[model samples]
Target chain A: MSAVAAALPLADDALVLSHRLAEWLGHAPELEEELALANISLDLLGQARACYALLGDEDALAYRREEREFRNLQLVEQPNGDFAHTITRQLFFSVWQELLFGRVTGTGPPAAVAAKAVKETAYHRDHAEQWTLRLGDGTEESHRRTQRAVDALWRYTGELFQPLEGLDIAMEPLRRDWRARIGDILARATLTMPEGPDADAWSAGAGRQGVHTESFGRMLAEMQHLHRSHPGAVW
Target chain B: MISLAELGVLRDVRLLDGGRTAEVELTPTYTGCPALEAMAEDIRRALHTADPRLARVSVRTVLSPPWSTDDITEEGRRKLAAAGIAPPRRPGPARGPVPVALAIRCPRCGSTDTELISRFSSTACKALRRCRTCREPFDHVKEV
Candidate 1:
């Protein structure tokens, strides 16, 4: 795939996830959690903007794209289930992103962006890790809920390790590092790893090829509603 | 009108063609910052006000050598502190394999006994921190 093609998937991943996090604005558990989630969402949105700007008008690309045209991973598009579910999703995605961006930092067109973004991803990963550990080891109910989230989201983790077309970074090392890091965090959090078939046959994914989960369309419609309704409306 | 330089986004300014035109370079603190366009427009307006004979004004956003908290000037830091926002600590060496805990002083009380409540705050570049001595919650600029 071309550079733009490769970048699109990465961009879409951030865009979709950013929206999902933004959904938590007023609904987070506490005031601090509310701001934290918004900040993370903004960071992801920034990354998406930087990548989209590489192609053309960032606003047009974000608002005008069809559902099938988006190349985000299915993991990011999955509905935010609960606090534990969101944290699980954040942990999985941020760990992969930290590792992926770490490799891409000094490489090519994305090097500068990756260099700046990796630091943010590191903080994101740390935030998720801290929460995972706290909730997992906190109470019996908290531990059970956190574990349930871990198992439910495990299936989606494999798609993150899959190789993108135009990116030259080695996937094997990233996968290895991701597994090692996540395994350690899970162990510390007193959470068990989900056991099942690998990402290829068992897990449901295919977003990189423009295929998405059923919920993605609904989320996209909501996200694009205002932009589509007003056409050229500006604040 | 707040100048881009005071906002800590302006990087460089140059007068070209024997002062007939002006060029300004700016870097956004965060990639998604909405103020970028407004800042550029502000620069253009300021230049026009300074010299009516100026034929052209160019504003560019530079991304390489990315913007960091370190770029915030001393004056800007004072302004931020006065506004009840803690300025970022001086950026140190590149992060190592192991995470290091850096002390964040309370902007209100100047106490080193501050605890990080969250790595993120209301904005992309700040963290939520609390001072143990003053018992006050404040915003600390994240060292980026």
Candidate 2:
């Protein structure tokens, strides 16, 4: 796999998730939370831009890409359900991201990117972990909602460990560490670990193959609207 | 506009071609910092204002050796505190004449009894905190 091929998966993941979080700007639970979500969104968007810069023509790659062309994990493409659901999704993805960035080897562009990203991902993971503790151990309503979010999003977690084509990463060890860390967090939060197969004949997968879930199309439509409407528009 | 140099993102400046052109290197405090573009533009405008004869001014973003809150200058920390914002505690040893503070002190009351309200705040570079003694909330430039 070429450099572009390796970088695309990471870039697309950041871009899609950034857009999802950006959707929460005016809709978050409170003002501080809104700012937090937006800042995280900006951070992801910046990471995506940095990766896309290595690929050539960041705008064309991002705004012109079709649903079937994006290499992001399906977990990121799922619609944000609620504050509880959003936090759970963040918890799942940020943990995976921190591990992936830390383990990616070599001094290539990807490694350089990962080196910088590992620190940011640590903070993102902490934000999610703190919220997980709050929602899982809070009142009856929060606990129920967070547990529901966890169960709903469990199957989507499997695709994260699937190795990208050019990136030299060992999938099994990454998966093991992910499971151990996630299990510890859930246990402390007083939430039960979901028992479904992370990857199997039943789990959702194939996002790496350019396939995506239903809600992704709507997201792409919104993301591409401004660029498509004016081919050469710039400010 | 005011704190760019104090923030320490400005890494270097060079004048070339008999001073007709200027090149500026900047290291971002965070990979996703939105202020980079504005800072670049500000530098260009400021350069032209200072030297109308300068034909070109280029600002480049450098990502390697990623920035830390420790890079914030001593003057920057003082300005932040004066503005009711807490400066970041250095994650490493003091390397300069000024000593680093070990506590995340309340900029309002100079009390060390502040609790983090959120790990993030109005910007990506800051964390929100509330002082237990003064009962006032403020932004703290979080250590990276």
Candidate 3:
């Protein structure tokens, strides 16, 4: 597969999720949490920019693309429901990214990007894991909300293991490691592990094919509006 | 606030095309560091100010040999502490997500009873920390 084809999925994932996290800029529960979310968002945005730069003009790729052209995971496109939901989303996605980047090897932009990103994703996963533990084991309401969020987002987790077109990753081992890590974190947090996507026949796996959920369109509309309106505006 | 040189982000500088063109290389502290662009621009301006003969100054970002806190020079660490920001301890080796949990010293009172307030701070490279003895909140350059 072409390098652009391979990098597109990873880039799109970062871009979409970065935008989602940035939405919490002024709305986060606390000042420190806002800063943390923005920092993570910036990191993911940087990763996306690096990957996209390798293919073509990064702005054009990010802002000019239609909903059908994006190759990001459907899970990332899901709305940040609440603090717990966002943490659940981060936990699911960060574990997959950390595992995937850790296993990525070879000489290229992807490898170089992965080498640095693996470290960043490790922190992201830890942040998510910490919040998961607090929410899962804290007050009774917190536990209920945390479990509800996890259950709601569980199906989307399966799509993460779905292999991209050009990336040379062992899907089985990646899937296994992801499952084991998620299971362990949930067990520690006093939360029940949700059923695997394999158990349910209709797991999400279509984002790589350029198909996205309904909310993704709205997100893209907001994200692309400024660039779409102005042909070549720059800061 | 330490200079990139002290932080060890600036890698190399070379004059190509018989000194008419200058090429500079830099590695970022993090993959998505926003300061990189500003740093590059600063280099370009500094080069022009120092010597107007150079017709071109190009800044390239290199990712190979990923940067770590160990790259920070002793001078850098000293400056960091002097500026009231705790410098990271020597991160022994690259390991898994389980941090070694080294006791961080407070830059203010020189106390080892500092606690992490947040894993992240104003920038991606720093973490928010507070000291028990001094009771002063400060930023700690994370050991990555």
Candidate 4:
């Protein structure tokens, strides 16, 4: 894979996550959660935009491309299952993101973009952990649901760490370090990791190769509809 | 309007506009536009482009009374629209111009019948709203 192959997926992950979080904007159970989710979504969108900007600023390159152009991990494109599912995804992804960002921020990538994303992901990780703990222990139903969500999403977690073509070589060691850090946090939280076929280790190749689950098609249909329909539509 | 003289940004004791450099008070587009740096840079550029001689100009970033939809002026709305921006959701009821409630009109669909789906949009400065009629998501302009 080329830099674009590696980069689009990174940007797609953030952008998709941003879209899902955007869904929970006013609809969150509470004002604080509402604000928090919105904030998280905003951060992710910012990260995605930065990633997109770096990859290709051309509207066509970013939004007008076909479904295969997106290279985000399946975990990100996964539908926002129930709230539990969504939170589960967040818990798992944020842990990884936080960890990756923590290490990357130390010294890797461009100082401006990477540093900014690193700071934002730190908050995302914190926010996700706090919610996981809350939902994991708050009530019987919430706890059970979140735990189940953990179990379901666990299968996809491995993909987050599997090295891919064109991945930032300098960031490889940090990515490994991130896995360990994420592992420690999950253990302390007493959260159960999911089990299933490795979403990231697809024999056909993972999302990094632009091979995605069915959900990506639908996501692209909706996301790309307007831009495709009215070429160059802005504002 | 607080006097720049109080902030010591004024060059002379004169109270007239020309007596001092143009005051540039910066407000985030919504709540947390993250594009603040870009916006700030834009303002500086706009100022410089307008008049390079305007030195000692003061640009203040005030977060107080955090931006609300209410702050959107008629002129701002037009500029936002012309810029292809979905203007801020009108303050008041979430639905279409409640006439009494003052909700924003949707850019995706001109329908005033809109409901705020989220108080936060992709950016803090904008809130997410859905047009009841179009079911399309739109950005509500924040007061800032």
Tens digits of per-residue lDDT for model 3, B48-76: 99989999999999987788888999999
In model 3, the Cα lDDT at residue A185 comes to 92
Residue B51 in candidate 1 has what lDDT? 94
Candidate 4, residue A211: how far the Cα is off, in Å:
1.1
**Can you tell me the CAPRI class of model 2?**
medium
Highest-scoring model, lDDT: 3
Residue A89's lDDT in candidate 1: 95
lDDT of 4 at A179: 57
TM-score list, all predictions: 0.91, 0.93, 0.96, 0.61
Task: List where candidate 2 sits over 4 angstroms from the true fold.
Answer: A2-4, A200-205, B92-102
Candidate 1 ranges beyond 4 A from true positions: A105-108, A198-205, B1-8, B92-100
C-alpha root-mean-square deviation, candidate 2:
3.3
**Model 3: reference contacts kept, as a fraction:** 0.71
- What is residue B9's positional error in candidate 2, in angstroms? 0.9
| C-alpha local distance difference test of each model | 0.84, 0.88, 0.90, 0.62
lDDT tens digits, residue span A92-195, model 1: 99999998987774445566667778878888998999999999989999899999988887777777877887777788888889888988999999998777
Ranking the candidates on TM-score from highest down gives 3, 2, 1, 4
iRMS of candidate 1, Å: 1.4
lDDT of 3 by residue, A66-90 (tens): 9999999989999999999999999
In terms of lDDT, model 4 sits at 0.62
Model 2's i-RMS, to one decimal, reads 1.0
Candidate 2 clashing pairs? none
